[model samples]
Target: MSIEELNQELTRLRQCLQQLKTDNAELRQAVLEYTTQLKQHKSEQQAALLERQRIEEQLQTTQQFLYSVIQTMPVAVFVKDVVDLRIVLCNQAAEKLAGVSADEILGKNDYDLFPREEADFFTTRDREALNSKKLLEIPEEIIRTKSGETRILQIKKAPILDSQGQPKYLLVVRYDITEHKQAEAQLKQQAIELEQTLKELQSTQAQLIQSEKMSSLGQLVAGVAHEINNPVNFISGNLTYANKYIQQLLNLLHLYRINYPNPAQEIQMTIQEMEFDFLVEDLLKLLSSMEIGAERIQQIVVSLRIFSRLDEAELKAVDIHQGIESTLSILEHRLKPRANHVEIQVLKDYDDLPLVECYAGQLNQVFMNILSNAIDALEEALIQGKLSHNHPQIRICTQQLNAQQIVIRIIDNGLGIPEQVKQKLFDPFFTTKDVGKGTGLGLSISYQIITERHGGSLECVSSLEEGAELIITIPVVQPKQ
Candidate 1:
């Protein structure tokens, strides 16, 4: 009985021991799993902390870069609150421009720093920008700083929107533009002045041309008068003789009648006293002289009328040669008055040229100026002993350069202009002659009429101690644009 009982108890004890060992092994596995889980959680937390630090550093760098960029920009930048229209933010440029520190200007309205009028203008513009929710640019404006310095500003304004698409602030940018505007104004003024000067010069030139023409006309009148005086005097003497002869013839008739009436002695005495035969011969001679004188006077009057046709205002096709002849007639007096030892000879090389379309009166003036100057040159040469024994000559040549162009040259052997004087010969009020003797405008006006008014060219060529040649080239036909 004892042996069976012992074996059963031992078996029970062995079973319990095995169960305890299994529970211990399970507990050890559970501890190792918990330790691995704790280690993994610590590693994840450390990685998250490092990521957060890196993002913070990046955010700080971005803020610093934006601040630096805004401060260094040339344009003044400012921001205002939309609701209150008060300045909320301003850059360093804006602060400097306003002549105030940032602390004093922040949160201040425009009215606090500027006059009421200026403030209202700024506020109106800001409101318009905010209402439109678009950029507004003003090309120019007047801005006054806190230091009372005024400047012209070019401004651009834009509205800033919040995340909800609501207007949050107004952004304004400004640049000074005073100097540029001033320069533009000055340039415009200078242009106006230049235009006025050109007009004045043109007017002065026209007056000069008129004066030269009048002088030529006066000379022409004197010459025509002198030429007619001799014929008129002869005609007057012949008419007186003819009247005396007619009286004598009447007396002879009366004496013959009386003698037949039975008074022979008295009739014979009257006939002898009258000298009837001689009176008859003289009367015929006087009548012939009077007829010749009347014809000569008619010719002069016709020539004068033809030459003065230039006084008309209408433009016409005119023969250039005829115009030249008329000008010579006008200058005839000047030539004869100085006809001493100096012989004035004219060499004409006129070609068969077509009529030119021009203002006859104005063109005549141009011719008169040139011809008068030439005559004066010859006179000067005579007075200065430069024309001794040598023939003082004037040459006039006309030629058709082409179908559309004509050239006329006037050459004179006189005291030629010096190079220095020649450069300014066409300048108004410049003359080599004494004051009151010559008006310094003849050549200047001639230049304007030839070049500016008629689109022709008038040029002078001369050498020291040589002769002067004036060449005028004009277009025969004006071209249509």
Candidate 2:
């Protein structure tokens, strides 16, 4: 009984021990699987951490690049929140222009730094850009800085949209344009001043021409009056003598009637008293003198009429020689007194030429001015004793340069103009003569009429003590319309 029980118990104990060993093995396998899974999970977590760090570094680099680009830009750049109209971001240029730091300007409204009016302008522009979702470019504007200085700026504004396509901020770019505006204003002012100066010059020229014409008329009137007086006086004296002779002849006829009645004594007395032969000869002489004086008066009147034809303002063909001759005749009185003992010689070298189309009155004025100057030169020479009375001469020549041009040259042997004076001879109010004696506008006006009005040239060629030669060249044909 004891052996059988021991064997069964031992069998039970072995089965239990085997079961314990199997359970231990299964637990070890399960622990190894759980350990491998835990190691794999730790490796995956480490790789994820490194990837996160790498992405963070890339993000830092991107932010630095964006900051550098915004700072280095030349034009002023700034961003403002559209919702609250507050400055969101600003570059280095914008901060420099504002005279403030980015930290101070950020989240600040434009009105805090600029005037309300200027701030309103910026607000209006920003609003328009956001509403239209398009860029707004203003070629020019004025911006006030924190220092209360106004700066001209060319500005461009654009909207920045959010992910929902809604405008979130406005980007503004500006450049200084003050110098360009100032230059434009200066140019405009200069142009106006130049135009005014030109008008003044033209007016002065016209006045000079008018004054010269009046002076010429005054001289002509005086000379013509003197010339007319002489002939009129002679004619009056001759008529007076003729009247006395007519009375004597009447008395002689009366005596002849009385002698018919008493024939001898009365006839002899009347003949003695009347001086019949003398009376007849005196009447004939008086009548001839009157006739000559009348002829002289008529000739002077004709010349007077021709010399005063400067009142009209029309162009016509006029013979140059006739004009020269008329001018000489008008100036004859001034010439005669000086030429009395000098034996003045005149040389004429006239060519056959066509009549020039010009304002006759104006051309005559030119001739009078030139010829009068010549006469004055000769007189001055005589007074100064520069001439020795050895055939002192005045020469005039007219020649045709071509079919369309003619030249009139007036040369004298008087003292010539000085070198320094020659340059200003044709300028108004510049003259070599004494102040009261000459107005200094004769040559200037003559030059105007010839060159500006008639499209001609008037020039003087002279040397000290060598006499002067003035050449005037005019076109034969009229200028084109």
Candidate 3:
């Protein structure tokens, strides 16, 4: 009985052991699978931690980049909360323009830093940009800074929208234009000053021309007079003796003829051949012609002296008729007809004028200038065949304009000047003639002499169809020195 029980118990134990082993094996397999799952979970957790760290670093970098971009911008940039119309951000340029720190400007409003009127304008612009949801540009605007300085600015505002497409903020960019405005004003002032300077220089130069012209004319007259005087003196001194000697010879011949009524045949033949009656008549005529020519020479010298008036620098009583006649004598050659050119007829209608109290040398220069210009006009007309039908002409008239003024008019019958050109007639360097043909300073110099030196008015009256007429009116009683 004991053997059987022992065997059975052993088998039962064996069965239990086998069962325990099976359970242990299954438990080990389950543990290995759980270990593999735990290792995979650990790996996944490490990857997730690394991903979160990278995302955090990227977010930090992006924030830094945006902050740097807004700060480094050159233009005056500002960001304003559209809802409250308050400033949310400002750049360095904005801080400089506002005369305040960027940190102080942030969260502050335009009303806090600027005047009420300026604040109103700024707020209005911000709201308009937000409402329109578009970029708004103002070409010009004036704003007072925190430093109490005014600046002209060009402003541009852009609408910054939210995710829901609602108004969020205004991004304002301002460009200052004060310097440009100031520069423009300066340029304009400089231009005005330049024009005035040009006028002054022209006036100075005109006076110089008048003085030089008179001096030159005086010297020329003296030289010509000295040259002609020698020839004239020799002829005048000998002419009296020559005439007396001829008269004496003629008397002796008559006496001889009277005393000897009957002559030798040879003497009669010689007298007949000699033509003694005709010979004696012609000798007297020759002497008279010499006297007349010498007289003409003396008259020309007198006219030249009158015209020069070299010593008349200051005011003097001068004969206007004598001045006119002297100018005419100098211009005699121009008035005469020439080959392929017609004579310029000058008509002088001079009134009985009082003795003009003026600078005589300068007065002579004026006469010469006016007369010369008139001749030039006539010549131009002739060259263009304009004077072929109507003869070239100049009319000079002088009269008492009033109790204290005298007027001299120089009118020409040539191609008329245009209104635009006539307006600049007396301006220095202005001319109607071709380049190098004229200096263009003659009339300008003359005008300054008549107006500035003598207290007068010189003006041109002309039209396109009718020719030019220059009028000069001088005070009869000049200002006392």
Top candidate (TM-score): 3
lDDT by residue (220-320, candidate 3, tens digit) is 99789778888888888888888888899889989999999779999999889989788888878888998998987877777788788766767888887
lDDT of 1 by residue, 1-481 (tens): 5977888888888899898989888888988888888888888888888888888888889988887888889878898999888998888988888998999989899998899999999999999999999999999999888888888899999999999887999999998777787888898999899976886776566575565666576457546756776777677667777667877876886687666765579766876698756766776776777767676565455445445563444557788888788667656666553446455788999989999876665676788788888877777778787755467788999999999889999998887879998898888767888878777777878887788767899999998668789998888865543
Which stretches of model 1 miss by more than 4 angstroms? 1-202, 205-300, 310-312, 337-341
Best of the candidates, lDDT: 3
Tens digit of per-residue lDDT, candidate 2, span 6-44: 999999999999999999999899889889988988888
Give the alpha-carbon lDDT of every model. Answer: 0.79, 0.80, 0.84
Deviation from native of the Cα of residue 393 in model 3, angstroms: 1.1
RMSD of 1: 21.9
Clashing pairs for model 3 are none
Q: Between 2 and 3, whose lDDT is larger?
A: 3
Residue 246 C-alpha lDDT in model 2: 80
Whole-model lDDT for model 3 versus the true structure?
A: 0.84
